[model samples]
Target: MDEKENSTEVFFDILIKNEVVMETAPLDEQKEYILPDDDYDFHAYRILLLIRKCGIINEPFFSHFTIYGRGKFSFFDFLIRYPFYLKRVIEIEKKPKLLDNLKLRSFETERALSPMIKYIRGPWDHRYDGIFNYMVSKGLIKVEFTNFNKSKKAMCLTLTELGIQISEQIIKEEPIWVDRMDIINAIFPKNATNERIDDYIRKHFPSLMLGIEGE
Candidate 1:
């Protein structure tokens, strides 16, 4: 099959996997699309892959006010939750061909199941805190502080040596994810202000910026 057909088939597989549509029934027979909650191992693996590839300075923020500032926290959710959005961002920024490396296909299979993936938004998934806490308990990551301003230190999440070693192993197992995180990192480089990320999200995904209650 051609690439488009292959991508379509992959998307259908995702829908079935997520129970968005009945696997045994026709594709038209839809089910309530309840978002799937990722398991600890799944979240752990992706988080490791993210930190491994992006490194400390470019890590996704745990919160906007803490790392970035207002609306910037969504970048974390964007990378972790929205694969197709990441793909589109890379395409729009004229980065390297995405499918060329198939860097995010694993993520695409899980989160990019539909073309409307970009429009899907909700409350920040609280599962992240649990995942980070678990990783911390295992000594995979540490909380460090960087100079946010003259007086304040910004909290930075960084991988430990063990984290780095395991992350490398993850890379060896799935090299396709090599530079996928870097594409987003390059767009929001070290010391980039919250406004920069906030503005970008507002421009591209205004709907997402709105509160879940539509504030």
Candidate 2:
């Protein structure tokens, strides 16, 4: 019929496709709500709202949709696209700590889903190197490539003073800053042991740990 009605129909189709709610007989009998005109941004927002109503998705995915729209992103794409988000999470405690590449890779692999994982093909992909190099060029972070006994090479990342200030300001403006900070604290507590990190991840993100072994 009209644009709103058309959008509602599309939304219903998505819900059915995802099996979020079963298709009912005579779909016309089902009531639909008015949505904004069939624009890409509005459509994406509507899909997110419907998914939330279905109670099927979780954080990062939820937040990612809110921030980046409906375009499916690889985990590397997520990191590259929202480097600041990851930076904010890593520096939530306001300390200039060294975040090793391994830790970053581990976090992404564990948290990102199948679609994202399949898209990125893991953290070692060249796409990730590009993102990091871009951040370096922007002076948002400092990277040090270290060679250990000429046998192993590792990259260490640290936020610059400017980066810290910018991240803090951005985090403060977030509506869910408090809740986000609490989650970060739980994930990376002070003086945290390997056992403690494992316990926290298992307790909080058990779904993410599926098929992933303890570190």
Candidate 3:
């Protein structure tokens, strides 16, 4: 076996012989470990910034951009959110020109070591609903249902005056996030539907066919 494979097998054999214990705590007992920037206010601010920059995004689109990073959307999310990891991917894949091709700068890529949110679906701590509700309560954003594609109602979030003001202030304070948003625009084509993205992902990452989304 290869050295890496041999080492992995040895590690698993050791793990089988040992019991690992993980510490846990209840909601009330759990202490805050996330940095101040990862707090609710910052999440709210990011939602506002997204709305301001991307225009009115529908629920599905919002989830795709923010929370849904599984299956078809995985690589796109990896590029958009885990930008530092993107550089590593380029290096490992030996696509040195990708860095310049994507117009990623060191300052922008250094903003995150990994994605801030864990992408999952189907009943986890889905932060979008809670944060949207909190923003609604704070009068920072309004949630409205609109007719989409002439058939279905789509729930959309729009920034209120307060949200806009706060988002603008955040933009002024930290413009690096604007570069991050630019990465999103660069990675995904304008008005590209999920089907197109799915097709592209399937073509590029054929292994994902085994674990199809929503299955």
- On TM-score, the leading prediction is 1
For residue 62, give model 3's deviation from the true position in Å. 15
In the range 65-171, model 1's lDDT, one tens digit per residue, is 12332234336445545666676676767876554543555646564421222222322445666877888898887655565455445445667778778887988
Model 1: pairs clashing at backbone N, Cα or C within 3 Å: none
Error of 1 at 159 (Å): 1.0
Worst 10 residues of 3 by lDDT: 63-72
User: Worst lDDT window (10 residues) for model 1?
Assistant: 113-122
TM-score, one value per model: 0.59, 0.32, 0.51
Candidate 3 structure quality by residue, lDDT tens digits, 69-112: 22223344344455665565456557565566455666765574
Clashing pairs in 3: none
TM-score: model 2 vs. ground truth: 0.32
- Highest lDDT: give the candidate number: 1
Which structure is stronger by TM-score: 2 or 3?
3
Output candidate 1 Cα RMSD.
14.9
- At residue 100, what lDDT does model 2 achieve? 33
RMSD of 2: 18.1
